[model samples]
Target: MGNLYLARHCKTAWNLEHRIQGRTDIPLCEIGIEEAKMNVGFLEALKISKIYSSPLTRGRQTATIYATALEVPYETRDGLLEMDMGEWEGKTALELSALKPSLYLQWIEDPRNVPLVPGSKEDVFTAQRRILSTILAIYKENDEEKNVLVIIHKYICSLLRCALQGLELNHFKKEIIETTLPQNLSIVSSQVIEKCLSNC
Candidate 1:
């Protein structure tokens, strides 16, 4: 019954440029740093005691901001990493839509059916499984009252949101997850809960 708060990392250069950054390992941009700093007040309100972050620099850096503000320990977890975009790693969502309209539509409308790479299978299931397993382990390790923070990326966030909603991966588009810089969510017993967006 512990509180789990999931946050998407702050903005990045790739983010500013409208690029899809799945597993690209890009660092936070200046705006990203400022955004992370701004998240301190929001996280402070949540009273988080510990943070778990994706190993990627963006997630790590964002996690540091909240952990420092809350005076808590933070650890990086590979299981929290972003989804692998394969050939689409560096392309913008707009670019994908323009270059491969049908594929892009499939990605947006039914992500589980379309491969990130043109010819490969979609890895949504794998990403969801890895992230869920890690979140569950963390939930098990902590007491029910502790408020835990998890910093991660957009695609991974989508998968996590889907898992929390008790929906299949293909239904990801049905719910809107806040993916803007430093978006927040709450979890209890590993179940994701949608709270008021203004409060998050």
Candidate 2:
């Protein structure tokens, strides 16, 4: 019954510009690097045994910092990758709203019902399933470990939060979880993971 610490990657240049970074492989900015370094103290207290990260650069960079600081091993997993935004990859929310109002509105109001954007690989529901399965697998693999760290993107974090709260994907925006996580680290207790697996 290991605990999973899900962390959002630090800021990036695109993050500063408010761009959608889905599968874009953007690196962390100076501030992001500093933020990761700053977080090491708190992470160290958790005594994480190992790290799993998304293959994207941002997630990798954050994981590297934590791994180096905590002296723990880290590996990248494709299943932990960000949702593919396709044509919407580099656009900001405001830009998307202006360019495709109906689709953007659907995304905001009910992500589960939003049509896949042109060139998008998976819709919100698909992304949710992928993340949930990935997390469950990781939890099972590290059952003996006391704590495990997983570095991922904001969208995936939001999806996991929705699932952990026993809410549907459509509740993403409507719930208190918000579209963005409050901080870098989110603690997913083993009990909650067990509950999620039963319902999954």
In order, candidate lDDTs are 0.73, 0.77
lDDT of 2 by residue, 60-96 (tens): 9999999999999999999999888888889898887
Candidate 2: where is the Cα deviation over 4 Å? Answer: 174-200
Per-candidate clashes come to: 0, 0
Sliding window of 10 residues with minimal summed lDDT for model 1: 191-200
TM-score of structure candidate 2: 0.86
lDDT of 1 by residue, 1-200 (tens): 45677778888999899887877889999998988887787677777878899899998888887778789999999889887777777887777877745576687776766745563344666666777777777877788778888887777777777767666657666654545434444554433322211111
With candidate 1 superimposed using the best TM-score fit, by how many Å does residue 76's alpha carbon deviate from the native? 0.5
For all predicted structures, in order, the TM-scores are 0.85, 0.86
